[model samples]
Target chain A: MNPYHILNKLLCEEEELTSEERKAFVEGLKSDPELVRVFTGWLQVHSHLMERLPETKDLILYSLAADGHADDLTHQEASYISDHWKDIDSVVESHPGFKDLTHQIAQDRQDFLDCWGSETASVPQVFRLPAWSYQIAAVIAVLAVAAFATIFLVNYQDRSMQLAIATPGEYQRILLPDSSIAHLSGPATLEYNSERFGRSVQLTGQAFFEISHRPKQFIVRTNEAMVQVLGTRFGMRSGNDMTQVILESGRVQVASNETPPRSIVLAPGQMTDVVKGEAPTPSIDVNIEDELRWTGFVFLRNTPMRKAAVLLSSSRNVNIDVDPLLMRESVTGTFSPDIPIQEVLDALTLTLNAQVIEDEDGFRIVPLFP
Target chain B: MAASKFDPQLVLRAKKGDERSRNVLLERLSVVLERFFKRKIGDQALVDDLIQCTLLRVHSGLIALKHPDKFKAFAMKAALFELHDYYRGRHSMKERSFEPELLPEKNYSINQSSGDSMDVEKALELLKPRTRRILELREHGYKYREIADILNISETAVKMQVKRAFEKMKTIFAD
Candidate 1:
């Protein structure tokens, strides 16, 4: 078969090229630099066509609404929107018809509100996300930096201290050189020293532990506090200048590392927060289940897509762009953070009747039909 | 990694039996949920029923949600369950596919691009109408066989037309 035939198939269709064809294309691109240039050109043209293709827009809104199958072109558009919502105003502004469509949507949105009995009475028309949104985003960035710092700080230790790190939007499960299991949420790191049979773990960010009981007390050292336990279930969140330890089903002694240090014993269902330069405080009455919600699967009952995107973006470490216009739209469903980002995007796209465009960089969510 | 900014205050309020906050949260998600169901079922009447059912399920289960931070994922999970149930019901109807009872308005328009780098649009405009339709269908992720079925043409014919369209695009770009 002609190689261009295979290349054309890959370029034109939304479905992935067959593995055999993809491999052939890869080999061809490698051997034929001209083919690479042509492929790049085709990609550029394809992107432009994707933008201008009216069918792509129709399919994005109707394909799933009309049929359950999400079209690939629409998927690309959705991913683009998710990644580029901030830049979309320029795109929309340039499109002469989009202004009219936005108006129509705003008007129809009112009709949609009437059908739903004016939930608007409860939800304000506009929610100006406070300027601190960036500050909040910075916390995740700091936690990510801290994760790396923890690894570098432990560099002098036995080379056997295995590091398990989760970036934002990711989770890492480590079988400590001991039999204990550590579930690390992203922007978090867990360094296990196996030499002593997982006797010590340095944790930064949020992690859930179901430690195995051993004769020796397992020591967990964090920036603000040290948690010592024999064996039990607990979760610790240490970052952005505060350390919180929640004992879910075990007893733990948390000691602040501050000068004139203070310590507290926490029973199951107790929680404590320790800040820099302060001693660990007394355990507070709390719901253990709530403290450890991140350890389990996530189910959104009636979550604004804006909030969902924020939660999913931070957890998954993928940038999800929600159109400011569609920020108020809510999504209701059960989803596990453990699922592939594409699946989550697919569900969100299908659920919101939105379009998701995924380029090589990341995912974008476009909530409006236009 | 830990999520930096969860709506802890809003969540705390909802958890404390603040029905108003709960309503606010639900109302916030309503548009997204509506779009979700409308996308899958494409039936105006059924979308309302499914939304209510999903909301009722959320209401019953909301008290048990310990962390409001996970509400989005939790709600999405419920909507997904409802979606599965919808498919299951549609399947029991014995139709080959879940045909939409109503089609949404296709009012979104595409403007022709006019710029130095927008030659692709100009090239696209040059294709024959039937050829353009076939390419557009393919662009929308339809298989050649499906496009053939939709256009009342043979699968081989669809492939030939698509190939020809690619050749035309290449020629236009090469110029």
Candidate 2:
């Protein structure tokens, strides 16, 4: 008797089995310990599944269009939905019936609000006017508000005062007041003020910038160095003691804030590092894309073990203690920020001929024993 | 359920102040939380907020976690606490129709918690979509007959899919 067959019949089938078939099922489970173990495991899995909820995106959409009170949504949810609105839009757009339904619903914001909003008292007053008349009135009201806001901004507000910050373990992409885009890995901050008309940004930590081309000098100031560009794409990292800049495209000038301050101009595919009170390193050719992996994952190519450790620690924001002797060993491979940290350690151990001890204090990388 | 090879090292690194490891751990567990919350809250928009709250607690409380191998259990406890806190904050307003019978067993043992499901989840990713769906339905307590009806397939097909999914899962968990 096939135990798997009998077990499946017992577990999955709804109909009652014959006396002989039931006998076979019980006999299979009673005789084979492996079958019993598998069956027990399946029961545990079933119990666990019973505790979980199904993924129901379609049902959620149905509820959203029918119920407008999204008080349940936090700020993150709103931003996520707004950012991925195209995905939701695409779904409705692909279907002609949904397209028509959305078009009808969109034209009447009040109708959507009435359906989805938690409040019901306003529905009667909102319905007092005809739909077309209400829409025209709403349009005028919106334009009037927009015109007032525009005048207020032109007359009183500072256009460039804004701050973009990326928190630890996160990435942020912000559009500068000047229309340039800044991508920052966490523990980074970018500050712009109207004093520079948004042309100058003070940066700490690490960031990638795509400056818009303009006659105005777009300057990025770091603790150790300053980057000046008309319009370009670049990546910059400022540590406690040194500042590094890599220009991906266009031209930029890097000025070190040393005692004997020196300025160097850089073209595409060039990188320079500046140390406080010391001259900046000569620009070297590096793949800027490869260096930009702090924002994502990067593969190392013939990188020394010491350098790899430093990169891993920096990227993960973790403390890694490596022996001085193993620092000279070289490793050539890729590292992804997605997998578990042990897997990376295992790979390092295999490649670099090293051993890692993970304890309560931290991870220690040492020379492998014979 | 036993801990898989993936999370313990990441948890160890995370506990040691590795922000990247922490982020990866959160990302993977957030998927699990999303599924958990979606079933409980029945509201998609609310799910993200609960997940964020759970993560905040997890992050703040991770330092106190004594065992790296028990990270999943610790995190899930924080998640359940957040759920309790949310309902308490709402003054016990019933957001949706929920029966106690449908709830997770109150006597659920942390030792027997669904740590193994993470491995099963990974294995399910490798299965055919139909087979995975069949197993998922089964996990949700759907009988083979019901799954067959829902999928418009034969009962034999449902049984075959369940067996195949279990076989694949067994192989994955073995490693």
Candidate 3:
């Protein structure tokens, strides 16, 4: 047999050669540099291609596995599987890459099917849209009616359209239709028109808004004020006849809800307050990370030990004390709220080179030597 | 974040210019691409860059895709293209010198560590466009018979093209 023929058979894994042919092929490779070069080049391409492209048969197997061997298989796919069942079984058993690919593809298929539901196959009929079309048309009609009903209900409910709420002691993350995120600290409610979601929202209590950018303004209304932004992130708290707005990044306009609606523009790291009947207070530069710490992210920007203790105490509801000598020492780092308070304390004390003494009441920071 | 599944409906919606759906699809594709690249290349930073590039390619080419159900195949091809680009770029940057003395060493085993210097992309460029396509289809896990069916050629012809392409690569690289 020609050496090139043997090389092709070996690379394609078409068939096992007889022992004599294998010996001749090995001897040719050992003696012939030109043949070896051809073999090497072909082998490299084959291996890389195998790594990059999934086999067609494996894709079919994957589809079968993904769809759970249901009646959903196409006639072609069903036939292909039947014809190659033996080869497919052997490959799945022996080829780890194909096995992994099949598993991954099946998992991905299941995830999407769960997310979007299986595609509704249309039943063929003479001179008409498939049966799914009628089903879809009926669904659309019903949805139209339901939409009108929802609009009526919204009007009747006086715009109390509560879309999301976090009760006391609960922290909830709401993904708005516009892809904006609202991290609501408990005792908060976010409401907006279902039909006109992402344009604006009514926020009661404290929440952090990461508004997706758009040309139109996104408005957040509170009892005492309204915050308007094109695209930006900010934190808002409305309660006690007062509303506070703090901009983390981007820009926002805070206005009082009073007649004439006094407004002020706030830059990043600035905050403002609105009294029930007064215009929004002048924007003041503030530590946004510290102010928005309620959103479960601790931002310490050169925060003094004394101030850090106060902030941690209020946020964690634990009394923290710092020795006078260490009070002025500051620490800077961002900590996720998920970190245990003890771990945070250890980190803080480690930075200060101090020791934390835990007592029945709370934690006290003192010099390690002392 | 959980890996997002491939949804043909989402692809259709995105192709129809649904901004929200497009965003969702891109986000989901990112998750899937991240996993795919990470599995292929373990470097986190490189994987991230590959994911971004693949997502961009998918986004730009989505409207041109004729079949929504083939989104996985389309996205995977885009990913493979990007990956190949990376490999080619890395090889060129390294400027690996192929020593003539190493020609005989190639006979040792395809699994030899030095096999990385083969520069498969360069060798692939040596083939004719038709032959290259056949080889590509073969690489994509298509059988020789399937390639013949796809290209409307004979199976023996497909095998002949592949063999000739390998011979051409050997001639070019042996110099």
Best by DockQ: 3
Tens digit of per-residue lDDT, candidate 2, span B1-40: 3334335777889888998988877876676676566444
Docking class of 3: incorrect
lDDT at A309, model 2 = 78
Against the true structure, what is every candidate's RMSD?
27.0, 24.4, 20.6
lDDT of 3 at A88: 66
Compute DockQ for each candidate against the true complex. Answer: 0.03, 0.05, 0.07
User: A158-255, model 3: which lDDT tens digit per residue?
Assistant: 75355788998688766565546677887899888643354789989988887766666889999999999988878899999999998887999898
- Model 2 residue A355 CA deviation (Å) reads 8.9
Error of 3 at B158 (Å): 51
lDDT by residue for model 2 over A1-370, one digit each (tens)? 6656555455445445666766676666556656555544555454444334222333233323434624323344445555656665664443332343333223323332332232112211123667789789999989998998998677545543667788875677665645566778788998886323447888988887877665667899988998999888788988788889988779999998876789899888799999876777899998753676775544466677777877787777677888888877777544434434665765667545577899876688987773
For each candidate in the order shown, give its overall lDDT on alpha carbons.
0.61, 0.62, 0.68
What TM-score would you give candidate 3 relative to the actual structure?
A: 0.42
The DockQ score of candidate 1 comes to 0.03
| Fraction of native Cα contacts reproduced by each candidate | 0.04, 0.08, 0.14
**How do these models rank on DockQ, best leading?**
3, 2, 1
